[model samples]
Target: MPKLLVTAFDDEFCDEVVKVLGSKGIHIHGGNRVVSIDGNSQVDSVSLENGSKIQADMVLVSIGAKPASDLARQPGLRIVENGSIWVDEYMRTNAEDVFAVGDCAVKRDFFTRKAAPVWLASTATAEARNAGTNIYGIRVLHQIQGTISAFSTQIGGVAFASTGMTCRACQKEGFRYVTATAVAPDRHPGMLPGASELKVKLVFADRSGIILGGQVSGGFSAGELINMIALAIQKKVTVRELDMLQIATHPLLTSAPTVHPVINAAHQALAKLRAVGRELPPVKKAA
Candidate 1:
């Protein structure tokens, strides 16, 4: 088949497709995004805007991002470097009398232990609950994990999610990352999605080989995949811990926790880590 190539910033689906297509001898150019092969193509790139050209079969724009922050304009809020509002653990904004949540407020990075964006709805809700509760002498018993935070998302159908950082994310932060991926069926029968596939990619820090981020896609819903991964990130789950997950699965429901897709993906990430000669401790039991 003269297969068409695709690109997506949140592409856990494309990877599985490419694997299937590769085995079938289908012809497709796979990458972050498909660049136009012919010169007679419209172009767009930060570098391209500065005068650059890319020749390829087609161009697939996969920019993974969203609304940054608008805290800087807040009359009373302290604007941080990235235009995010500085908030205390209770998510209190500079006004002290006020609190910010979601995209508006800034939280600390779990990895670098620095102030950063906690823009996910998951984080937002948690911060909001805390901010609201804490506003009137309410003390949240759970001290939000500082420095490291996690998030999850599903794409193109199959469930995919990640916690912590991605290889690309780590590189931007000047941190060395180790990664692994697990490819398997979401069902025990394996033929349920005879036409469907599941792919998981997990990235971790090379220094500590700690689970940083993950992406999964396949079957029906991938949101849960990311959720579990987020927990892994919040608890700083190591590949070893993930390897020992006790996931509940109903062939039509999920992968066995003993061999959960997410956990397996961690194992895969572990292999990649070892290949680089980085010393990673045994997988920690899932908390």
Candidate 2:
């Protein structure tokens, strides 16, 4: 394959993708946009706004879908400027007793409390469950206030996963944040067969130590590892708590006990927190 362009809202994740793809001899063009096509009858090459061109035999454009709010509009339901059906924390629509979920419903970010354009089946199902449980009357199942935007994907034998807010999102949303990264072998011993390198990055609120987001890239286990980080974010786990986290590690299943990437990343953030004299107590050494 020729050089390709991959765009993402998370700058760190985008760079990680570039690094992984680059190692496989795949060239990547970051932060560029296709301005025009070179061929008249077909796309022989594509020109980017940066004055670089990519030769290609095929061009695939994956544009996002907008919510079909026209029908909902006829019933006097409210719509956001982006045309998605507006809904409350419980997925309730503007009209009396009306509920909306899934891709068509507008979403907000969990920490930033800003409108989120993310769309995913998992998120939709979560919203559906919240709405379904609360339709008749409010219950103990808490109403969902915003979307965490947890997601994962794999490329070139590496699984990439992320959740909550990226550094870009934090900056754009005007949150003070700090970030740290750690690298480790995915197996107990690096010499083990199928052992792959794992990299974990975490972002936290600068003052409070609350986890803002996390990114992981590594072996197939990365798909599930990031989910655990996502759950921590949902439960409001801080960097201090993550540094003290306990987990089962096996020679065939996980990283070495001394160098787990997630805990080490939290340790990195904890060091920074201590430097600033934050109130977070240092986490006890992991066993």
Candidate 3:
């Protein structure tokens, strides 16, 4: 029998991708690297480093792109270790009056301030706007500092999106964190047309309750939903504040206000923090 295998790095987003694709009859061979492709006249199969062979009529490889910095190098522009043009926060190159943006420019991590290999059109657009406005001088007081790595995609009729860091990433980076998840129908009533179960998972700092990341999986709304989470991460919103957020909802358009997935997930995180006897930031009383 023939099969489709998708090998990917072990991460929360890729795990969700595997689950969604698996439900649609696609197999995922994650955490396995393909060592070689065996063929005669046409493509035959791929051999995994673990001594496993996957029969394949075709192979689709999706390695990430490398920055083409040859042009920038010609002018003695500083190139980072990752083969991308070194650029400041305003996308200005080391050369006088020269700027680089998009995939060719290096990006830094929002939290770590280290060089990050995140190349996306959305990130590039933000860089371009900053570079354009600051061409003459540093007119823009506030500017993009680093890449958040917000990403979203649709697979098997389900929209899966994530922003900021994942639990695995937190562990690897030695961050003390807590996570919580909630599920609710996208529409107020489960019987509404096009209603889908929206699942939300949130990660927060262990004691401070500061939101570190979020993941959403559901209908088309998940795309915008992840953007909201990205904003929350950027603003360093705490679980308590997120849980108390006021939201607009309608029976046909959104889930019940009482059971909104994002808010509920925050509530769950707060409970987890409390259960662990972690000291949480005091909530400010509205004047």
Instruction: Say which candidate scores most in lDDT.
Output: 3
Cα RMSDs of all predictions?
7.2, 3.7, 3.3
Order of the predicted models by TM-score, top scorer first: 3, 2, 1
| Per-residue lDDT over 167-236 for candidate 2, one digit per residue giving the tens place of the 0 to 100 score | 8768777889888999999998888999999888899999889898988887888889888988989888
13-85 in candidate 1: lDDT tens per residue?
4455566556777544433243333443443322333244544444555644434554346476676756777
**Top TM-score: which candidate number?**
3
Clashes of each: 22, 0, 0
Candidates ranked by lDDT, best first?
3, 2, 1
The global C-alpha lDDT for each of the candidates, from Candidate 1 onward, is: 0.62, 0.83, 0.84
| Tens-digit per-residue lDDT, 150-253, candidate 3 | 87878899887877877867887898999998999999787788999998899999989999888888878888999999999987889999989988999998
- TM-score for model 3? 0.91
What TM-score, computed on C-alpha atoms, does each candidate reach? 0.67, 0.88, 0.91
**Worst 10-residue lDDT window, candidate 2:** 1-10
Candidate 1 wrong stretches, greater than 4 Å: 1-75, 113-118, 146-160, 193-195, 256-259, 272-287
Q: Of models 1 and 3, which has the larger TM-score?
A: 3
- Clashing residue pairs found in predicted model 3: none
Superposition error at 97 for model 2 (Å): 3.6
